[model samples]
Target: MAKTTKTGRPISLDSVKANQVIELLKSGHYMQTALEVAGMPRSTVYAWMNGTRAQNSRKIQDFVDTIKKANAEAEQALVQVVRTAALGYTVERVKQKFVNQQNEQGEWVPVMVEQEIIRETKRDWQAAMTILERRWPDRWGRRPPTINHEENEVTSEDLPEDFL
Candidate 1:
């Protein structure tokens, strides 16, 4: 058998089989069809799908591995673009989607990013409050009472008896 470099190195027998399975799957081969064609056990295929099996008899594993690699590359590229370029006139904002999960207490909760932002905003508000306190010293330690100037205005009839 003539051996050649398939992916920068000699392709192993298992890898070749995995590639064959992937091709068959992409060509509309169903699980049952692949099982019969590959002559591998059904449990083995399932294990490969879940990444428990190290060997590549199941074609789905190969597809999943490829997808993971592609996702990582895409994330890296996006990070590079954001790091190298400065924001234009309009600020770029991204809305993150969080999946709710149950805790040990069985209560659903938001992801960590939401919690982190809340903490950051609270810290910022506290800092602003400290700055305000420095700028305006309160007379009574509590916030200065808000007074309405309109209520204190004196009408002509209310002038002192001496003036009238």
Candidate 2:
């Protein structure tokens, strides 16, 4: 038997509600949204994760670890998507078309034919720039040009006497 709150909600990490929340998180859902979708209170979940409710429980620790793993998986997936967008890709589209043809019986018949279309997507320059800037900030990132006031400044002594 698992522990439950007064309202009959399971407090254990292995509960169905917890698993639902975990799956939602793994699928890239936000924490609040996952909790809401799973019918779990955000406050309670936060309390468990932060160790405010069950500070010394092994189950709580396991739950926190699982949430972290799910979030990491989601982040990895997002990174892969961004990388793919930056590099661009080719996609094949399949379509079914109906063509009118004359059969051996001299009757016009509708025939279904499949067509494959290949599409090439151009690379996203902005996304590539973003990746470059993040991966090599010192080399690709934008920065203000450095200026030396003393070197560029012109004084009366350095100027021509007649002009001063």
Candidate 3:
């Protein structure tokens, strides 16, 4: 027998579906999209996380913990990517090529070989500026210039000659 929610909807506590959702979440998919891709209802997952449903089994609790861990991992990965963008980094690109080679059986065979190419990404000035401004707003953020209202007050005497 399967567990049902208060609304009589079957709670899909399938580990495979949960793992699929976790993987999707780790890949930066939003909760709704992940649930949809995993063939699970958004309400079911949210209810498991919120413990709003009557099904308070150990499986549900474990599923909730797994979801939280997956979310944290995704967030950490995103933060690392942002930090890397703020500070330039290098990446390795791999390419595979097929070449004809003589095999031990005295026959020509196609062999696949991998070639790695290193690439350097330049730091993004905008990303760096944004990080600096947000992290140290008092020093790097833009602020409106201070004006002395009493000294800069305008009067009718200062009007242009074209004005009556």
User: How many residue pairs clash in all the candidates, one count each?
Assistant: 0, 0, 0
Estimate TM-scores for all models. Answer: 0.25, 0.62, 0.58
In model 1, the worst 10-residue window by lDDT is 115-124
Error at 39, model 1, angstroms: 2.5
Clash list (residue pairs), candidate 1: none
The lDDT of each candidate is: 0.54, 0.83, 0.82
Q: Compose the digit string of candidate 3's lDDT tens values, residues 80-107.
A: 7778887998766767778999999999
TM-score of 1: 0.25
RMSD of each candidate relative to the true structure: 26.8, 9.0, 10.1
lDDT of 2: 0.83
Error of 3 at 151 (Å): 7.7
The model with the greatest TM-score is 2
Q: Candidate 3 has what TM-score?
A: 0.58
Per residue, candidate 1 scores C-alpha lDDT tens digits across 47-160 of 655767565434455555753454466556654444334231233445566878899999999775542222111123443444446556563234656878789877888888
Candidate 1: residue 39 lDDT (0-100): 64
